[model samples]
Structure formats: C-alpha cells, structure tokens
Target: AEFEIPGYLVWGALIYAIFGTALTQWIGSPLVNLDFQQQRFEADFRFNLVRVRENSEQIALLQGESAERQRLSERFGRVVGNWYMIMRRTKRLTAFTSSYAQAAVIFPYILVAPAYFANKIQLGGMMQTASAFSSVQTALSFFVSTYRTLAEWRAVVARLDGFETAIKSAAAEAISTSSIGVLSSAGRDNIHLQKLLVNLPNGTPLVSADSFTILGNQRTLVIGPSGAGKSTLFRAIAGIWPFGSGSIAIPAKATLMMLPQRPYFPVGSLYAAIVYPAEVGAFSSDRVREILIAVGLPQLASRLDEEAHWNRMLSLGEQQRLGLARAFLHQPQYLFLDEATASLDEASEAALYKLLEKRLPRTTIVSIGHRSTLEAFHQRKVVLRREGDRFVLQNQAEGVKSSSDAPLA
Candidate 1:
C-alpha cells in the first residue's frame, strides 16, 4: 500500500506539471502587452508637454494659457485613466493567479490523503507525495501567474507598430506632395524663381510669381503686410517649406545666411553660441571678442567661457546684436534679415546696418522689415500685394539714389 500510494502521487505530479506550463504562457501574454501599451501612452503624453513648454511664450502672450492648460490636462487625464484601467486588470489577474497557486499546493494532498488515511502509505510516503504534487502544480501554474506580464508585452508591441506607421506616413507625405524642388545652380549669377507658387500649410495659395531674379551683390528689401507670405517666400528659398510649386536657382558658390528677429542660441559657452553653425574653434577667440565689442556687446566679450542658457540669458535686443556679430564673422555672400534688427533702437539699428555696409560691402543684403529706416541700406525694394487669392511681388521705383551704386569690388 505504501508503494502504491507513492506511485499515485508521482502520477498526479506529472499531470500537473504538463498542464501548468501551458496555462502560465497563455495567461502571461496579455499582461505583458498591456504594460507595453501603457509605456507608449506615457511617452506620447510627455512629448505633448514639451511642445507646450517650447511655445509657452506665444501662448502666454495670446492669453492662451487656459486653453493650453485644459488641453494638457485632458491629455494627462487620459494617461492616468488608462493606467488605472491597466492596474485594475493586473490586480484581478494577480488575485486569480495567487489563489490558483495556493489551491494547487493542497489539491494533490487532498486527493491522495484518502489513500494514506486508508492505511495505504506511511507518514514518510505521504510527505513525499505532497511535495511532488506541489512541484507539479507550481510548474503548471506558471502561465496563470505571468498573465499580467504577457498582456503588457503585447500592448508594447502594438504601440511600437503604431508609432512606426505614423512615422512612415509623415515621411511619405513630405516626399510626394511638396512641389518645391531644391536643385543645384553651379555658379549662377542670380537667384531665379520660375513660375513659383507659395502656399500655406493647408495648401491654400499664398503667393505666385512668374519670374524673379535677385542680382548678385545687390541689396534688395522685401516689404509686405502681415500674413502676405513674405516669410513663406523666404522659407521656399531656403528649401524648407515644400507646399509650393516652383524652381529656385541659387548661385552655386554663394553662401546664404538668414537671421530672424529672434535668433536661437544653444545652451553652452558663449563662444560656442557665437559661432553656432561652425565649430567652436572656427574663429579665433580674439576675433569673436572684437566682433562682439563692435556690435555693442562688450560685456559679453568676457563671458565667452561662461556656460549658460544664452536664449533665456540675453534679452531680445541683445540677442539680435549677437546675431549681427555672428554675421560679421561668417561674412556670407548673401544675408537675408527677417526683421533681424527690429528689437534695437533706430540709432543702434542704423549703426548696425552701416557697419555691415562699411565692413562687408560685397555681401548682398535682403531684408524684410516694416521700418522705413531700413530702406536707406537697400538699393531695390520688392513689395508683396494681394491679388485674387495669391500674392504678387511688385518692384518699387527708387526715389533717392545712393552715392555707392557701383558693384562691390
């Protein structure tokens, strides 16, 4: 009877072990999927927060703080609510798994106890029977215990698949729908636009020009009303905005630079911030100091080694001056200023323009500004006027001819 009882216990253990492994895998898969999905949702929510922070200034100025806050709150609320759902599901799964495991330990003993009690096995035999039964049940219950993890894993796979799809869609759209072509113009004399059409982000026509050419080494000023597509035109020239149909032929060897009203400064040493598009050692330390002093930023000359967030460290006016100092150092063949000097006073702005005229006479200047003071620096003016649904550039006749009309030597 003792030997018979041991045989029965061994048989029970074998059966439990076989079933437990299969069940554990089945239950664990869903839990892993759920956890993975939760992580993806959390990442997306954080990305939105970064977007809000980057545009906080504009939002605050336009009194959009409440709206942005509400939007962010809605996004975060979804994240929290989804996480709670996932947690609850996990809790239920854990409860079931734990109970099943506990019951599994005792189930074999309960069944075999009848035989042992019936004088079928010794005490040692009975103890061994129970241990074997528990081992079998533990192995079989693996799936039930790991079900949550499996769910989380599946969720992660789904989120990653979705992100991939989104990236592909964005990339395809960028390639196929844009009409702006960036082509090479090896050593061309002028920048030409042929049958150019500029559009807004929504594909609405903003501007159309049949043919235009910006002569080399000639200063040209672009004037337009708000939202008249001046900046859009510039973006088209720079090959960033691809929503328009046109061909822009730039000089092959000409170096072009654009300085906006608010120039971006990297958060690092002042030296690194000054020669941004170039490496830190591109210019000598002394040359950078000289340019800074010339632009009325003598104080910053000593701070070249100091590391800080230059964007938030300097005011808008100071930043504009820094941008001009950069321009002086780079000395590009062509410079486009989109209200780059609007922040400074008229005197300072005039002085900086004069400095450019005096120092870099050969560099062509194309500026977009509302101030009349800017007209004195440029030889030609082009204004954008609204037609039916698009803007057209019209050249304005020059009233006062400057003395230095000769092409730069």
Candidate 2:
C-alpha cells in the first residue's frame, strides 16, 4: 500500500467512471423512444384542437359539442399519459445523477483519509490530494452529468433525419428515369403524349394513351365512370404523377393550372385568397372586384380586404366561383377543371363556362365531369373508354362514344 495509496484516487475515479457511464446510458436509452412518442401525442392533441376550431360552425349546427369534447379529451389524455411516463423516467435519471454528484464530492476525502490518519501525509497534503482528485473526477463524469440533454437532442435529430430521408426518397421516385417524363415542345401549341402510360404507386396500370394530342385553344372534356383513372390522367399531364412511363410534350413556357373539385383557398383576405400563389398585389383591386362580380360573387367584391377562412365561410358553390375567379386572374394558357363546377346548379355552371370563354378566349380549357350538361361546353370529347385492360381518352362526337372512335386530339 506504498505507491498504491497515492494512486487510489485515480483508480476509484476510473472504476466509477466506467460503471457510471454505462449506468446512465442504459437508463437513458429508453428516453429517445419516450421522447418521440411524447412528441407524437402532443402533436395529435394539437391537431384535434385545430380541427375542432376549423369545423366549429358545423359542430354547432349539429349540436355535437359533447361528442367533440369526448374525442378531444381522449386525445389530451394520451398526451398527458405519455408526458407522465417521460416525467417518471426523467425523475429516476435526475435522482441517480444527484446521488452520484453528492457521492463524488465526498469520494476524494474517503480515499485520502487512510493516508492522513497513518501520518504518511500532512493535513495540507491530504487536502491538496483531495482537490486534485475532485478535479479529475469532475472531468471524468462529464458524460454522466449530461446524459439527459444528449438523449433529448438525439431524439430531435433522429426525427429530423427520418423526415429528411422520407422527403429525399419521394423526390427520387418522382424524378426517376423510369417514371413518366415531361418534355417541352417549343413553338408547338398543343401538348403531345407519345406512348404515355399512367399507373398507380403500387404499379397497377391505369391509363394508356399513345400518340394523343390535347389540341391547343380547344375546349376539351374528359368523362369516365367513377374510379376509371380520369383524374390520374390529368395528373400525368400536369407532371405530378410519375408512376408511369412515356413522355408528355408540353408547349414551352406555358402556364398551366388545375382546379380540383374542392379548390383550396388559404386563410386570408378575400383578395389574397382569390389570387393565391400569386403575389398579393399581383392583380389590381379593381380588376379582382370586377372578376368577382362577373363570377356571381358580388357580395365578396366589397369584402376584398376582409380576412376570414374563405373556404369554410363560403358555400361550395361560392367556393367554385372563387376557383374560377382564380383562373380568370391567372389566365393560364391551359386550365384543367376537375369537376370544378359540379357543386353549382346546371344553370350557374353553364354561365360560368360562358364567362370563362369570354374572359380567357385564348386559354385552352379542359373539364372533367359526369354531367351530360358538360358536353355542351367542350369542343372535343375524350372518353376514358375501357378497351381490354387499359383506358384511353379517344375522340368522340356528340354523346359518349365507344373505344372504336379515333384517339382524342
């Protein structure tokens, strides 16, 4: 115990450092999973609260406050329950860390006490030894003290990494060489599809159109039975659905817009919502008001500056009008309307189409609808006729025709 007595401090610190680090790591491993779960629970609870707020009008009309409260309470209970679990685990970690720190402070003296009593070292020498031991022990316990912070930081980093990975994967698939291709045909007015095939994400073939042309400046209508992939065909032309092969040659420098059944309007002033995705001051206030009036939304003309959730505040018919207003504002060279007027009565729908023709005479319009009335608007009828195992938008005259007709141009 000659030289061994002097080295005892280092030996004791080394032993504790190994065991302490291992203990903290083992105790904190579960924190990552718990932290992630807590985040999900909290996010879900917040989402439900926002949903109720957005749909408050419908809830009030249905007198479903009690049902909403029950659903929200269940979500909140999960949030609190998961948070409690995190607290319990954190409590255990903090307790161990506190106990470890207190013991570490006294640990140096316990090691030096034997030499001080044996008279092998003076009081000053013992104190100095304890001080050096304390410094060394502090340096060695760095990881042990900060395990909680490390665990939480790792959780956030892991979640971000997961999101980034998912985004990259989706981007890669969308632009893959094997997927559908979008090409630009300069100086050409029409969009041409050569050997175009569209499929679902699961590789199920949906639409097959080879050597089909969407004639420029001509009003086109696409009609098919429900779930016949008519919408998917539109997506393919828009260059968003990439699960297929073949090239879609679009006119160069052409601005295209697609209005879905339920058009989206960002929560903001009527003027801003109507001309969304465009700068706020892109269109003059006077022109916007005029267009709103033309679309049969005279009431919204004066409320241009009024801020509200336009989608919820307006009925579906009114929303469709606003969607058309967006088209008129943008005046895109190509416009695809996917049942964009189905909510409106046949009379209003017909008026809207006529206004579209008058306002954007040069814009090529495509409409997707089930109504027989829609045929009166479009010049060329493209039916997604089922031939064998696939569908094509072949040309038709007057009423809906069979696949024996020529391909739609």
Q: Which candidate is the best by TM-score?
A: 2
> Alpha-carbon error at 402 in model 1, in Å?
3.0
Q: Mind giving the per-residue lDDT tens digits that candidate 1 earns over 1-409?
A: 3254456566676666556556555544555655775686778789989888777777889999889889889888878877787777666666656766777778777877887789767778777777767766666556566566556556767778888998896566557646776566875557888888888868899988889888887778899898898887888888777787877888776788889889988989999999998998999999999999999999999999999988878889999999999999999988889999999988888788878888889898889999876787788899999889888988887674452542321
Deviation in angstroms for 90 in model 2? 0.8
Per-residue lDDT over 1-409 for candidate 2, one digit per residue giving the tens place of the 0 to 100 score: 3333377678888887878888888877789888888778888889999999988988999999999999999999998888888899999899988888888888878888887899888888877777787788789889989998888888888888999999998899888977999998985579998898898898888899889999898888889989889888889889888898999999899999999999999998999999999999999999999999999999889999999988889999999999999999999999999999999988788888888877898999888999987777778898898877778768776754222222221
The parts of candidate 1 lying over 4 Å away from their true place are 1-79, 99-163, 399-409
Report the number of clashing residue pairs per model.
36, 1
Instruction: Tell me the alpha-carbon RMSD of every candidate.
Output: 5.5, 4.5
TM-score of every candidate: 0.75, 0.91
Q: What does candidate 2 score on TM?
A: 0.91
- Candidate 2, residue 47: Cα displacement in angstroms equals 2.0
